[model samples]
Target: MIKQILPSEVVAVDVREDPPEATLFPEEEALVAAAVEKRRREFRTVRHCARLALAELDVPPSPLLRGERGAPIWPAGIVGSMTHCAGYRAAAVGRSEVVSTIGIDAEPHDRLPDGVLDAVSLPAERVRHAALAGADATVHWDRILFSAKESVYKAWFPLTGRWLGFEDADITIDAEAGAFQARLLVPGDTAEGLYLTGFAGRWLVQDGVVTTAIAVLR
Candidate 1:
């Protein structure tokens, strides 16, 4: 489902169940050893997916260490993102030359908890969500919107090394086309230069899950 929304050059690996043979390297093990069992399992499983994605790009399975902000530090010349949710874990990667930055997120097909919509979205976004929900009550658009903002922030932070609150990006969702756009209300820099505008992305709700992805080329 996620692969359908990413660029052709991007390789995405997804797993619905934990990889039976997954194992973390020494460094990775140290980072999560103190974590709870569930956290350790999810971390190893997602990293397994990441390794598979990198392998698809002909890159070896190198140690994926977390940066200062807890973001994965990719190997040189590679740009990628990873996400995991209930029963879903995935990672997408591409050559840095092809994709300067990328972000992907997954969430269960469920409504946000009470008041979360108001807290994470602007007034206009809530209005749009109400309209969308009225038209199609089957899928949870609010959660999808939240996931989209997460992807945007993941992509934004790598380039700018700064924080992007949910309210910082005004997102417009096009349910009919299964797409969305985000207008950045703050300034940020990209590999091409400073990009204070926005980002275009693709989204999908399938198999009881909502997935969103954004890929920015140089």
Candidate 2:
């Protein structure tokens, strides 16, 4: 489902429920050695999906450690992201020669809890969501926008080593196009000679989940 939204060079794996078990590498086990059962399960499940994605690229599975901000550390020559939520887990990867960075996120297709949307969105974005909500009533536009912002932050942090607040990027979602564009309100960078003031990504809402992704070319 998410593959349709990403570039052809990227490979992805997704599972509806946690796998029965995952064989974690020694280093990876230490990362979650003290975690609760549920946390360990989620971590292992997403990592399992990631290894499958790496295998698709003909790269052998390796230990994926967590960075300072809890982002997955992919092997050299690879760029990827992993996400998991209730009933869903997914991973996406691409070769660095073709992709400078990639970020993917999945969220339950439901309204933001109470006032959570206000915290995650700009006033203008909320207005846009209102109009969209009335038209395409099938998808949760607010949640999708939130997911897009997450993708933006994940991709941006890996490049700039800077924090991107929820309000730092103004996102515009085009439901008809099944895409969104995030215009950076802060400083941007050049990826592979392309000056990126913004990132354009694809999104999909399906089977009670919303997935968004961005792949910067190198």
Candidate 3:
């Protein structure tokens, strides 16, 4: 399902269950050693998916560690993102020469928790969400908006090494096209010399999950 939203340059792998064979490297285990069972399982399985995606690019498996802001430290020359939610875990990776950055997220297909919509969205976005919900009551636009912002931040941080607040970007959802665009409100240049302005991403709602992805090419 995650592969459906990402570009061909990216390699995506997803699984609905934790593979019993999935085991975290010692370093990774120590990172989650104090966490609850659920946290440990998700952490382990998500990395499992990440390694599979990396292997698709002929990259050898390595201990996927966390860096600034807890983002996964990918192998050199690789850009990737990982996300997990109830019953879903996925990872997407790409060669840095072909892809500059990648961000992906997944969430259960449900309404945002009370007050979460307002906290994570601009007023204009809320207005648009109302319009979308009024038109089609089947999809959860608020949750998708939150997930898109997450993807935007994930893609943004690796390039700029900065924190992007929920209000930092204005998201517009194109319900019919299964896509969204994020206009960055902050001003900065990416490390690669590109003026960081906005991002275009794709979203999908399927089989009780909502997934969003952004991949910026070099």
Candidate 4:
């Protein structure tokens, strides 16, 4: 399902069920030792999807840890992202030499909690959402808008190592094309000597889930 939105250079794996073989490393286990069963299950299953994606690139299985901001620390030369929602887990990875960053997120296909839409979105974005919703009332534009910002932040953080507030980027969605663009209100310089001003990504709504992804190539 996630692969439908990503480019061919990326390896995307998603699962609707928790695999029995999805075991966690001791380090990863320790991080979620005190959490409830649901937390543990999602965490373990998502890493399993990540490992499977990594293996496709000939990368050996290893402990996938987290760096600052809780982003998954991928194997060297790899850029990736992971997301899990009710009844779904997904991971997407790519060679860093070809892809600078990757961001992916999934959410249940439903409206945002009351006030969440205003909190996470800029006024212009909200106006756009209204226009979109008016055109096609079947889709949950607010949820997809939130997911797009999440993907934008996920793609932004690994390079800048900074926090991206929900209000930091303005998202524009193209409902017909199943695509979106995030224009950064606060641009930053990356370690790779690139100044990121915006990101273009794709979105999908299917089988009761909404997914968004961004992959920036070098």
In the order shown, the candidates' Cα RMSDs to the true structure are 1.0, 1.5, 0.6, 0.6
User: Which pairs of residues have clashing backbones in candidate 1?
Assistant: none
Off by over 4 Å in 1: none
Error of 2 at 58 (Å): 1.8
Q: What C-alpha lDDT, on a 0 to 100 scale, does residue 194 get in candidate 3?
A: 79
For every model shown, the clashing-pair count is 0, 0, 0, 0
lDDT per residue for candidate 4 within 34-138, as digits (tens), equals 999999999999999999999999999999988887999999999999999999999999999999999999999999999999889999999999999999999
Q: Which digits, one per residue and each the tens of the lDDT, describe model 1 over residues 46-137?
A: 99999999998889988999995899999999989999999999999999888878999999999999999999999999999999999999
TM-score for all predictions? 0.97, 0.95, 0.99, 0.99
Candidate 4: RMSD to truth: 0.6
Ranking by lDDT: 3, 4, 1, 2
Best candidate (score: lDDT): 3
Q: What is the C-alpha lDDT of each candidate?
A: 0.92, 0.89, 0.96, 0.95
lDDT of 2: 0.89
